[model samples]
Target chain A: MEYQRYNCGNCGACVAVCPQQILKLNENQVTKDPGCDECGNCTIVCPLGAFTWKVGHEV
Target chain B: MKYDVVVVGGRIGGSIASLYASKDDADVLMIEKRQEIGTPVQCAEGTTQSIFKILDMKPDKRYINAEIDGATIHAPDGRAIDLAEVSCENFLDGTGYKGYILDRKVFDKHLAIQAAKAGAEIMMKTTVKDLIRKDGRVCGVVAEHLGETMEIKADVVIAADGVESNMARQAGLTNPNKPGNIGSCAQYELFGLDIDPHQLNFYFGREIAPGGYLWMFPKGEDTVNVGLGVRSTKKTAYQYLNQFISRFKGTTPVELNIGGVPLSGPIDKTYTDGLLVVGDAAGHVDPVTGGGIHIAAFCGKTAGQVAAEAVKKENTSESVLKRYDEIWREKFGKNLEISLKYRNAADKLTDKDMNALAEFLEKNKIENLSKISAIKFLGKHPHLLMLIRDLL
Candidate 1:
């Protein structure tokens, strides 16, 4: 998954809603830990539409 | 780099603080993590006209979306009660009336611009990583700015960093929002809604929002901010928002926003040695209504003014910074206490209880309701008072 740095406000809204608890906000970007299940929760919870799945991968 | 004051966020509270601090001729710098000042907006953007008073200027046409005269509340049984006759006075100024739905992007940018014009330096895309402490006092911050890690020192640091504040924790202050204190929220900007453009609407029901309410605030002729907030529920706010959106036909949203609201009273302490926390970072939101813009504006200005004065006096100790806390608490503490009490009482109310309360208000010819009024009404009815006591 790729998150757009330009649109992210770093509000940590996505990190709060992530069920996997893999999302962490560092500096101004949200990063996912290796226990990676692409649940798409961060993509949906982001207020700024900043998160997007990598190309060729379905959310 | 060293400054008289360093504001950790460039949102409404931070911008206002910086503006006032700069007006006092203090060297101030505001840092924002986003590329744009107000990108990925988090507010419902509803505030009163008295914002003009705080800004000390007339209303700017660029940011005003709609002027609201009153509100209409919908009960769980679909009964609508108009509060047009109710006086919605400004909580601070106490003279002005009417609500406004703002274009937040423009409004926030305008505030930052005003601060800049007043001699405050604003740096976008700068994120504060941690506080630099010396002998238990926050002396500066370590931040990542423009791909470079740098240390910025300041006489005073203002943490207006929203609900997810790191400054408070770094300063050794406990997070004010406990498990049930924060309200999870989701909002959508929708068009093609058949809603009155001059009034706000609120829908309340446990089935809809367990411990919160749904709101429809008009932005323009055909656009509205449709949103919901709930606390401590098994379902996410997104699910509740989607379920609410399904009820309206022929409406599609153009934007989506999600965040958390501190529905608790102000934090136990907002001032630490050489540091002050304002806005949502300080939990300055009303517990019952989930409104914080006015509180933010009021407290932010006070914090800025006091900080500037303290710096001028060459003292940035917690004792000097404590004045900000005292002033704000004197102004808003009782009101917040009442709001929290009402929230506690309302949390225990069932759908039937809410319906009865609404009907009772209608029967009494009460058009406008406030926390004090609600308490008085409950006082008159022993059964309701008993219910509230049991819940508490």
Candidate 2:
């Protein structure tokens, strides 16, 4: 998995949309779990561009 | 007589701000224009489960009528999207949380109670006529209380005055909302109704309420809060709500809240020297959904904390209070900005496009719907999808 900088504002939109408990708010910002499988579940779910992929893909 | 902090408008943000300030060794006071807390409620009061964590209090069962797991979004063509239910706290703690349908009047009062318990003096039905300024900085508020115009002194003032935030405008922290950012919403608490109590229902139709959606929230076995929100561009919330209620074919209304949501983007600046703006007053509602409860609370708490910190430092400059805005922006600003872009995209969607989207969802699993796939689903209809793709 390639590394990316996601500014997750922690509104929990992604958490609200995530099927799995892979994302959460840490210190008022959103964070993904180490167990996250990168199913693009969060990237697809993010209303904002807060979630991103290792390789740039159409959101 | 003076105070360390004075919060104007005892709504969600104001109440929370007062509580935060008072709890931190500040002499805080909260003032409201209404005779009672949370009266003449304007909100649908549907809030995400994250509220508990935001307030750091367990909501008494009386305030929370039910815990909403999922929602049913029905399109104008009778197409529906069933958003899956996730654990409420998990949603906020991790990805996000479930929301609650509250009686805002009760909830707002509860918030004030928390503030009062924190040692903030609560004043009701008192209107702030203007800001008290000195050397080009705000020092307090000039308000009318019980037929007397009075000046209350404070080092800093927090404005949580809701949509028509004249206090902020008078202080020059924000301008009155432009027409585009306002949403007119109207709802009826209908008695004697039969509907799903668990699943919140949302309806979208071009003819029903253009530029907005209708909602049916079952309060209990026979009572429901049914309402519609239409963009001010299309019609007044009152006009759309009246038409929607007529189509209800349900029992008579027992109560009603006809109001507008300031879906406007957050003000460019939320603070001035000695003055801080919070809640709907600062136009902090979500751009797409026009929901402001959780965010209002979040910002209010932030404002309260920042004001308290400022008091500790003996500084109340716009620069100092600006920490509150920075915190709020760091937390929710970017997301709201992105949602506004989506709002632009959604507003341009035609009736045919909406109907097509509804039809597409009708044929698919409602549980799988989200922004990405929803866009993808809409993209399937070559013509409609192409239009959306190009626009997005």
Candidate 3:
């Protein structure tokens, strides 16, 4: 999934639905570690549409 | 650092758990990732009076914005069903004060203060990075605060974490919530919106919120919380909220809040060995209404009582902690299950169905809801009969 960080609300919606648990939420920013299986759970749960299915952005 | 219990998150669940656990004389520590207990509020702040009953506290105006006695539900065809005109027999949850709109920013911190007064230690701005496990059983947590990492040991760890909870996942009590089961929501606190200050308004239609609905909750003094939730949709909930907000002129948002609510029923398991899960972490939220404050308070109290008992017994094993699950389930399990069923059935409703139901209910107001009138209404809206049957 491609993350539009600027649009992120830091609501932690992505962190809860991330099956791999790779997402981490900070006070002001949300970060992701490597090893995303790309289940696209974050894409649908985000209130701001921060995460998107980009197919192969940089894989 | 070591304590009898370490509760993650400092919202309704965590603070209540901390308060009850401390009241029972168990050494407790509650951790919060945010510096403040409640800010950037997520909820529409509507909660039943049952929560105050559960907390054994009076409704203090410092945190309560408005007291609502009724609600107005708007259908797709512009029909309105005023719940005040209906009798108690029509309500699914039975008769009581409808609800209260809370200033969560004040309420959350007040609850945390109550926990502190009850002897629970609180650590702010600390995030638990991982759980501390020993011998295949969860024991405590490794947390970070201001770049300092520390491992806090506790006999039992209560995961009162919110929607973004990972402690339960790490302990193997549950998995991530499916997107379909989550209510992706956005709210705006508007400064100048004129409406009934004592009544709640709900708008339902696919165009308003595809999988969910929109709510306009009056927060006293010309302020209101307008929000919506949707699921599995390409358009974000924020966009849906903006479309609905655009209708009211001369209104500007003062604060924008975003959140995700787990609409699934409680998780398969709430406790495993030394760990207990409560609140949104355990999916204690009611699916039909997206409300969890009362459920969280009840479960938090139960978990705290159980945790204290386990500590006194000198055993914090799964066998001892499982009592928490039994107690909360016995109180709310069947209700949540029924609500989830209703939510699933309601998800299938179309604009025509909603308008038909609204029209039917409005005609069957308290004075007109006779036996023959009900039969005639059903005869006219036969499809609604099927829908209600499916819900049941």
Candidate 4:
């Protein structure tokens, strides 16, 4: 299955809805700094479809 | 005055719902009980790096607490399984969002701001009293603002209240949670203990959390969020949580946090005439993991988008709202269902089983525990594997 990635130019749109605060923008690029727990909020919150994961990957 | 949509709760679900509706040019009003967003954080605040792609946004360093390089899994018997492998290539070099720990207060307020920027009106310190139905159909909501009763009419209403969603029940949707389907959690934010910044830990077994688990997510140098969750069955969740919290006696003294997690899947039905329920209020938490943040937002976005479509169609009936259900099933319901099935199987696992599972992890490089990997691992144990296979 095709994975999800947004042509996001480092806009902080997905970061806004993160309950875990995992998604981060560093050096004007989107990054997940250190404290990620795979809550998936960032993926669902992004307006540009920038956050994507393999459907059958490990949870 | 009537609006296109009225969202109760200004949290992620509510805010995202408003954003979706307003994006379609629908007038949306979001109400929050708190003066500020994301205060008194109720979650473990850990999320995968890839979640940002789904939201089309990224967080900054300001909200991040640490970078997790790997996770350590401890079985009921205290055996450990540690994995530092990053499945995503280039993820470690910062080319991709690695993963994050966050400050929810700033994060939640930011979501509210984004919703407003998307043209949704937000009201803080506003509480919904009840759902207004006309002819067995939802038409609006009755709310209290600063002790004053006010009636607001909307073409559609979205319920995003976390757990214990009174609004959903008042709207006539069947309650989806029972004691067996809920998990209670208690945690402490300790500041004095030196913790490994790159390692996250999960301890499991009936002794620590029957049908649940315990976790340690380090925030920074000498700080970590230590907590435990126990399934709410015959034991009252409060009783179990209090006893569990006291176990941190020799560790250190710090802030204490308590909350409940709905392990049941969403209600069989999540829509009614002119109304839709999203997030925890709809019981969309992950059954196996007790994580609801992503599922809730995904539900919220779908609800918001579908509600917008209903407004545009000029049909706010139960049938129209049912479309949201279809959208959710297409996107998240299947995975959630699978997770719940896994949870049921996990619930049947004994402390001995947990010890064996932990030892297995320590022995093998199943690396990260994915649903498929877990199933494959249990394949050798015919009885347990068969049970899980049937459930899955």
Best by lDDT: 3
Order the candidates by DockQ, highest first: 3, 1, 4, 2
For candidate 3, write residues B1-392 as lDDT tens digits. Answer: 89999999999999999999999999999999887998768898998888888899999999999998888899988888887777654242454447899999999999999999999999988988899999998889999999999999999999988887789999888888889999999999998899999988999999999899999999998799999999888899999999898988999999999999999989999999889999999999999889898899999999999998899998999999999999999999999999999998898888998887788778788887898987787788777688778876
Model 2 bad stretches (over 4 Å): A1-59, B85-97, B233-235, B366-392
True contacts kept of 2: 0.00
Which has the better lDDT: candidate 2, or candidate 3?
3
DockQ values, each candidate: 0.14, 0.01, 0.75, 0.02
Question: Listing every candidate in turn, what is its Cα RMSD in Å to the true structure after a full C-alpha superposition?
Answer: 5.4, 15.7, 2.1, 14.4
- Whole-model Cα lDDT per candidate? 0.81, 0.73, 0.90, 0.70
Using lDDT as the measure, name the better of candidate 1 and candidate 2. Answer: 1
Ranking by TM-score: 3, 1, 2, 4
- Candidate 1, B34-113: lDDT as tens digits: 88887777888888777777778788769989987778888988888775444435432353437788899999999999
| Backbone clash numbers for all candidates listed | 0, 12, 0, 31
* Total colliding residue pairs, candidate 2: 12
- DockQ (model 3, Cα): 0.75
Which residue ranges in model 1 land beyond 4 Å of their true spot?
A1-10, A13-28, A31-59, B85-97, B367-383, B387-392
Model 3 scores a TM of 0.96
lDDT at B195, model 1: 85
